[model samples]
Target chain A: MTAKQNTQNSLPQTIFRRKLPKLLLSLFRSVFLLGVGFVMLYPVLFMTSESFKTVSDTFDPTVIWIPSSFQLYNFKMAFDLMNYGQALINTVTILIPSVILQVASCLFISYGFARFKVRGINFFFGLLIFSIIVPVQSYMIPLYVNLQSMHLLNTSWQFYLQALLGTGIRSGLYIFILRQFFKNLPKELEEAAYIDGCNPFFTFLYVTMPNVKPAILTITVFSVVWYYNDYVLSGMLLNDHFPLSVTLTGVSTALNNQLQNMAGQTLGADIKLLSDAILAAACLIVVLPLISLYLVVQRYFTEGVERTGIVG
Target chain B: MAASTEQKTKNKPKRLRSLEKQQRSWGWLFLSPWLVGITLFFVLPMFQSVLYSFSKILITDNGFELESVGFKNYLYFFTESTTFGPYLTETIWQIIPSVLMILAFSTVIALVLKSNFFGRSLARAVFFFPVIIASGVVITILKDQVMMSGSSVSDMSPSYLFQAPDLVNTFSQLGIPDQLLSSITTILNQIFDLTWKSGVQILLLLAAVNNIPGSFYEVADMEGATAWEKFWKITFPTISPTMLVVITYTIIDSFTDYGNLIMQMLQDYYRNNNYAYSATIGVIYFVCILLVIGLVNLICRKFIFYASE
Candidate 1:
């Protein structure tokens, strides 16, 4: 009986040790992931591909699979209508300053929270997070009233300056991320700086900031993406002064008009094709920079999230 | 010689203490920009909102005019306003279902992705990319193609697909009944409402899962506990802090999104100088949110096992 039981247990162990099941399981998981991934990525691909399709081919569901011909003229027309050059300049104008200010202010505040043992720091920090929790929409009316009172309404500077003051959506997430990183850093390095007669500010500048470079890069990329794509607030702040995102809306409005006038135009197919090209061109112009930034910093951003130990 | 040198050096710092004080003063001085920004911008303005919530303001050729109203705004919200009750109810109604779904879906996704598998990283990237791209502007730009103006997305397509009919038709032909189809559609619609919106919660859940110690799982195996038991005992407790974070994040995210039509109504009210009605509605919605958060916290406290320090 003992021999038989030993053999029975050993038989299953031998089968479990085989590599086939694990490999099959992994293959199954991969296929499932790929299917889901395609589903997720389809919309993006559809929008991009249709941009290259001709106007008459656009509504033809059969042609949706791929563009028959890559007509680049649609892009030219779209660019002209949207004033892409001017909008790109305006976008950069806001993007650069807003990014710099957001990173700088968040760095200081996060450093303060992480390094100092000041009284009531926790309370104040909690309040800051509370501000983040409240819907920004809730503050819109009040913000408008205050800005109107400041006589800063309807100016480009209104968006730029409000963002620069660490009050933008970028700062909240950036500050939280940076603080988590700062908290995790070994205190020995700053202590060594102190031993070498360096003060807290200098130590932070030379030692801490350099160490948190990944987090800083993450913040920079995040700010560019968030502030650049913002339309609702940007819409309210800059009346008729269109950024790239806003210009996309303006172009959409124009496309609808072209669509409406299709019946009268002799060159209806060409016009539709032109509209398709413009839409694709516009999407490409706005999305390409951010996507590239994402691809470059993708590894660092993921690594930084884990390193900061800020899963939440 | 060592003792004498140490003592002398310690005394040296005290001798130059006045200079040290001046140097230290620069810390606060360095902080002056933040101080000015917070006081004038954040602190002062926030207080002004609270004040404005109670009082009515009238614009003039001169600076603005203010009329003191005590409890009138609060009373209107609780009592007589037509939209205030329904608006508060609708906002809360949307928030609860949205948050619950976010928690359930994100938790499952995080749990599945936590396993070591092929293409896991890519899967995560795909999941996260929507959040990166789908801001208000991107959505607004896509609105013409994705949704029709003056249509409650549900009414336009099927209330379930954000008006994306192609996907719905595919699902329907899978031999699903109309009622079952409708329910599935509603769920899909809700999922669409919450997916990109819950990025913060997903990150939190991932953090919680990562924090669970491997030793606990090893011990559970030694005791002959099943995989399910290990999950129940070890994984669940470890991630409770993250659960709180996700809950709080989801509730606020769903509530404050500018896409909500009711919020737009509130905005219109304020723009039209209907301050009293807007404040009443705002305060009601604010209270409802607080109550929901409080309930979640109370319930979770029972199960959130904190490791003994």
Candidate 2:
């Protein structure tokens, strides 16, 4: 049909007008994506390269992508300095419970919102959105004081309390995401369960819970990332037994601590020179777990987000 | 529910009330945790903070004391505190264009990501890499490294590897108003930051686009719609609702961002233990955010095309 119409016109003109821009547009898109992707990945690649760079490599202008020599010692130094094992342990101790509790509580809360639109639920939903925002800095001091009074300031209990109660970091946003999933679910499934004389609680457990596994996995990944990446609260609250995030900001101090333990004093001179690579190594070590987790769950996470129909 | 509580009063209305009670009770069972959590973690703290904002907070060894000062703390930002006012204005100004640019960038990227292309997964993996490092502490650590490496952030921007701008520089070199120049230059310098921040928004818009019904596009094709026309007619309307979600999310995300200037201002006040002033700053920021979100929601909702069941 286009050939008949295009018989009157020159074929090259049709191709140029119709096909050229389309080809150019696609070409532009691919280049844009690849270019932006490279930009996005540059820091990671830069850090990776920097983590292995030696003293000589830093001064070498040509050594952008790779170093002249690989320095594995930076990893060892960063690991020791960061107190990696202890920090990881502390992080996990806080992380596991927060992820589990936040997911469970948010799952329930979101289900409730999705299932039943009672009077004033909108108000509470508004409040949930408010809580997602409303900068934590505003009320952080009072919260600190409260935790201090309860003798939970330095303990993991503070994290637990918030997570268990569905008020942890970004919990409201999780609730919002999960609610979209629950809301989109067919009502017939629940009605069928109810017709079978299944009670609401049991139906929630047996019927609704299993269907939202993708969302649970997504939020689980999110909660883990958030809690693992959390330093502000942990830094303010904990006086000792700092998590990976806390140690991250103090990699230099960790280096000092490592040296002090071994040599009875920090070798302050040349500390900056040595720290560049060590800092890069520490960043890699810190984010390695999260990156792997995201990689493993990314396919499912994307699918889950799509299925939730993230509409208005 | 099978056995109505009031045996004496056997009526449909009574039974309906009981069912309503059952539904309400079950719903609240699931919702009560949120209620309790909000009360303890949010309402109380938020109330106390607002009160603290309106008063003078004395950090006594035993506990803090609040001396009511009316609107003095609120007044401090405009009338006295220099950083808070300027920083807040800067942040508000930055957020408007930042949000629009992010939305447009994300929408395009999301379209590309969801569409079939060679090495798409690799591209996605690379694009989403920022989500791993985009958290406040990690990104700050990276930025600190960049700073410590004896290169200014703009000179050694992550984008500098691929993007060497001549036009941007030429445009900026051409005299513009200070406010517009500052904003544009700042944006030019922050291309990497802005692009990096698009990771989450891209994921969100990708989800929304993926959620679009295939039938809409098929129908558009049957009607001989061009790609651009189909996008504007089908994809645009279908995804308009999610645009609201993205808008709200981006606004909150940008405001609550770890490296935010206003947050830093609040931090400085906080480090000095000036709780009242910080509270005022937080409140003002909070109100500003609410206003922005509300206004955007109102505007976007009017255009939203909700697909009926």
Candidate 3:
């Protein structure tokens, strides 16, 4: 067919005419996408660049994209002001165990929804969806009052307990995702395990769980990031022990206090540059770990997203 | 042999019933965690919140006391309060445009990224990076920096199509309606914020697009279908279910967004020891969100394609 078309017209002209629109379209797409990519990355890059800038360079319009000179003092100042080490430890302490517990509990709940034939199961599932739709703030005041009465505030137990019960932030969505993944799995594997005298619990642990690793990973990533980024819940719950997110929010005041203690000066009108730099440094410190984690697990992140979407 | 087979068949139904009962027990057992969670975290709190919304909550050394007010808080919100009405309207306005913009922008971007173009994977990673660090703290910090730097946000971040002012001017010269012009500029001005929020939606859409069976496309190609035809015919219908999911997610996310004015107002009220008012506002906001979600689902239901089992 191509040879006949070539005979009907000069081959080179025909090919050029055929390819011209496609080439133009591809070029347009590439430029547009790249431009959008730059826009997406600009804030992070700006944050990074500003984090290292000296107070003078931050205000210098000429030094827009990059710092004229990289200064380590801002990081040092931010670290001391934000109590970066302790906050990081606090964040990890709260996030890691909660992520594990949430993932495990959600897996169990989703497995039940996916595999078992229970009466009124759809009603129960509707409750899960309700949990997702209702905003946390609506119930937060009551939850806070209850926790205060129980003296459960200012501890990791609040997060851990919720996670264990499969009610932590976005746990409903996680369960929904995992349920879809589990439903799509072939029933033959579980049947085979059952025929070999495996109980349901053992079958779930050894058979179903292993096959849904991608979904598990996806939920874990989301759980970790969401918990890490959470401020309102953590801020309300923990008073003495603040996570990186809560600490970052208070960095400005902390910086002001530190300046007052060090030089007997307030964060008055003239201190915008130093304050901005310090805040940017604190923001970077807070986000660095998650960024590195995402970079390391980029492949699994994308795969998990794809798998969840398909199953969902 | 016939007597034995009949006996076995009779036993099979009883055995199956027992097995079904066992499965039901196991299912409830597995769901025990969620049941407890729902009761304690969701149901109890929701009940308490509703009660609190209807009463005046006074905190004392011993504990808090709730005195029944019976719709006074709701009345104040509706008739007395000056800020709630505007804030609610502002939130509704914000929700509609942002959700629509995100859906449109993300679907197009996902389609573009779905194609096998050069550096496509890298482009995807770039688009998805926001989801990893889209915390309220980070966004607030970045937004503050952008404001402090004395550069317009549109200048710092690329506008969706063109600078709002330029687009508005051109459209005005072209005699576009005032209403249309203002709406266009409002959406364009929100392009930066919309882009950030669209990251997850884009990923979801990209995944959905990729999930379409290749055979469908091959068949379309064999039929000499144009790219546009293929998208409208094959791609759109196949991905509509995921599109519904994305729309719901986006709506919920936008309503509860940290930067939302209503949320900020509610937080302020709560901080100022106005628990009843805060709870009232929370419930109102929640009902609004539910209405929006219901409306969206109803609209999308006609188009969503659920594959028959």
Top model by DockQ, which number? 3
Chain A TM-scores of each predicted structure, in the order given, are 0.80, 0.82, 0.86
Give the winner by lDDT: 2 or 3: 3
Candidate 3 chain B, run of 10 with poorest lDDT: B152-161
Single out the weakest 10-residue window by summed lDDT for candidate 1 chain B.
Answer: B150-159
Q: If scored against the real structure, what TM-score would every candidate get?
A: 0.76, 0.87, 0.87
Q: Who wins the TM-score comparison?
A: 3
- Put down candidate 2 lDDT per residue, B1-309, tens digits, no spaces: 557756546776777777667788788888998899899878988998999999998778977799999998777778886677778888888889989989998898888888777777777777777766787477787776643454222344333542336645676578666687666666777778889888777766776687776777888889899889988888888777667767888889999886789898888889998989889888888889988888888888778875533
Badly placed stretches (over 4 Å) of model 2 are: A1-22, A184-199, A202-211, A253-271, A302-312, B1-22, B147-183
> What tens digits encode model 2's per-residue C-alpha lDDT throughout A1-312?
898876867788889898999899789988887778877887788778878876666656666667787669889988987889999999999999888999999898888988875668889888988887798899998788777877888999989988988899889888887776676566777778988999888899989888776567667876888898988889998999999989999986666555555553533444454576778888888888888878887776766755643222
State the weakest 10-residue window (summed lDDT) of model 3 chain A. A303-312
Q: How far out, in Å, is residue A224 in model 1? A: 2.3
Q: Order the candidate numbers by DockQ, best to worst.
A: 3, 2, 1
Clash pairs, model 2 backbone: none
Better-scoring candidate (DockQ), 1 or 2? 2
Per-residue lDDT of model 1, residues B122-161, tens digit only: 6777766665676646554444453332111223231223
- Going through the candidates in the order shown, the clash numbers are 3, 0, 0
Question: What DockQ does each candidate score versus the true complex, computed on alpha carbons?
Answer: 0.22, 0.43, 0.46
Ranking by lDDT: 3, 2, 1
Provide the lDDT at A34 for model 1: 70
Q: Which candidate would rank higher by lDDT, 1 or 3?
A: 3
Worst 10 residues of 1 chain A by lDDT: A303-312
